[model samples]
Target: MIKVKRVYDAPESDDGVRILIDRLWPRGVKKDLVDIWMKDIAPSDELRKWFNHEPEKWEEFKHKYMEELRSNPKVKVLIEVIRRSENVTFLYATKSPYNNAVVLKEYIESLLTK
Candidate 1:
């Protein structure tokens, strides 16, 4: 199973391998909060700045982000990690529920289904 969680949330035992997926370390968050920090798997700086978490731009952001995932070699590394784990959690610092981790979870699920 895959889970998406905010970095600020209290850690749970069922979270499994918690991986932070943000390009930058979130302020006030300690390094020990996550099991792994996969910053490279996050969106590129260009795309992240473009979207800016605007609800209206979500569709376009998702499309461009999917393109990035398709070409990113780091995705294979994430996949390998997921395959080895019974459960995995993606951690992000965004306040919005519709953040990069949500998109990444959806993208990874699609890849796993194939």
Candidate 2:
């Protein structure tokens, strides 16, 4: 199973194999709280800066982000981890709940189903 969560939210016991999919560390969050930090799997700096979490650009951002994920070697590593784990939770620092994590979760699920 795959789940999405905000990095600012308190960690839950059931949040298995928590993976922080952000290029930068979330301010005020401690390192010990996160299980894994996959910066490579996150969107590139240029794409992230361009999107800026704007709802109007969400569709384009998802398209661009998906392209990034497809080309990134770390995505295969993430997929292997997901395949080995029973549950996986992708954590992001963005205030927008509909941001990259949402897209990534859907993308990963698509790969899993195939």
Candidate 3:
């Protein structure tokens, strides 16, 4: 199974292997805190800038981000690894609890789960 977690959340063995999906490391966070660092799966710099997390642009962001994810073969393999694992957690550092990781989590679940 796959789970999504935030950087500020408590890390426990039950949460599974944690992978940080941001293109850049979250500011002020320690390297040792995250388990697998998967920058390859993150949205490209151009797509990330285009989304910008503006409320008015969220729908478009979702669409574009999904497209970005779909086109990347490397990301597909990452998703496959997570699916093959007994459990894995996608850890991100966005302050808004419903931002990048949330969307990506939903997308991943849809693809990897029934």
Rank by TM-score, highest first: 1, 2, 3
State the displacement of the C-alpha of residue 81, model 3, in Å, after optimal TM-score superposition. 2.1
Using TM-score as the yardstick, the better of models 1 and 3 is 1
Candidate 3 residue-pair clash tally: 0
Q: Report the CA-based lDDT of candidate 3 relative to the real structure.
A: 0.78
What lDDT, from 0 to 1, does candidate 2 have? 0.90
By the lDDT metric, which is better: model 1 or model 2? Answer: 1
* Candidate 1 collision pairs: none
- Residue 41 lDDT in candidate 3: 76
TM-score of each: 0.98, 0.96, 0.85
Better of 2 and 3 by lDDT: 2
Off by over 4 Å in 3: none
**Ranking by lDDT, best first?**
1, 2, 3
**What would you estimate as the lDDT of candidate 1?**
0.95
Q: Could you tell me how far off, in angstroms, the CA of residue 49 lies in candidate 3 after the best superposition?
A: 1.7
Candidate 2's residue-wise lDDT over 1-114, tens digit each?
888999889888788999999999999999988999998888889999999988899899999999888888888899999999988899999888668899999898998899
